[model samples]
Target: MITYSTVKSTLIEKGTRILKVLQFGAKTADECAPFGDDSNPIANMTAIYAETSTVDEQVIIGYINTKQLAAPGEKRLYSLKNDKSISFYVWLRNNGILELGGDDHNLVRFEPLNQGIAAANGEINTELQKIQTAIIGLGGAYTAGHISTDIDAAKINEIKCL
Candidate 1:
């Protein structure tokens, strides 16, 4: 979810240009601006504005390119292609808008997902649940207190769900 803080920051920094969340559907890739001698990326500009909790303007200010221009700590620009509709969270930069990471929130940003450990825990939880259920079915002494431990419970509960 987009948070109020994100909107506030964008407004403070961009002054006139505001952040917008947009959805583009069934698009085709075309040649766009070249980054260097070898990298020529494709882009699409057709999009429909998505409503935000904080901002209500429906107009899209600028075109969004498919190429991802990496900032500091990034390796290189990776161009994106759109055939089906996709949502973009963007802000104005260099006379055009650059796509921010795909956080569809219009008010507050959600914490990033930690898939590495979560995946392992989810797998363990699934197995634990199966074993617990089987023991109870066989009239064993397994009870609710024997449920999965914290190692198995610390998966996706804290992350906001769409």
Candidate 2:
């Protein structure tokens, strides 16, 4: 039988990294900007909107990329992705959005593709759970702690008696 602790530990260790990436916007060219060897075109327009609470004080900014030379009245607007959800605790700690003793809240918008990414992430997590169950089964009850140490010892004594 599967125990809550076993699943909880497995989920916490294996799921955290996957969840972090799925929840936060992946570090990609689109998010980081300056696709190739080109310099940042929006450097002049970049403005720091907020600073994180972490020791490093990572800042979030608003900027306009105008290297492509858009037509008059046509300008590019950058926004966060919809599927990635930043944690309230992390946001508070990293973004400094809330004061040290203040209540945390959602200060950023979700990406447009958030639904699709979230669904995929859910499927992956479910698959991991199934895999863990199969592994424990193959390794036997002792491998998965389905039987208590006392019961295992008792079983060993019965086998020794035989």
Which stretches of candidate 2 lie above 4 Å from their native place? 1-111, 140-162
Tens-place lDDT per residue, model 1, 103-149, is 35443223333444466667877787787799989998654332233
Q: What TM-score should be assigned to candidate 2?
A: 0.20
- Residue ranges of candidate 1 with Cα displaced over 4 Å: 1-113, 144-162
Lowest lDDT 10-residue stretch of candidate 1: 2-11
lDDT of 1: 0.39
Query: Best-fitting candidate, measured by lDDT?
Result: 1
Write down the lDDT that model 2 would get: 0.30
Residue-wise C-alpha lDDT for candidate 2, range 1-162, written one tens digit per residue: 111110001012332211111112221111222335222222123322232455433322323332342345443322222232221221123333333223544322233235555676677667766777888779843222221112222232222211
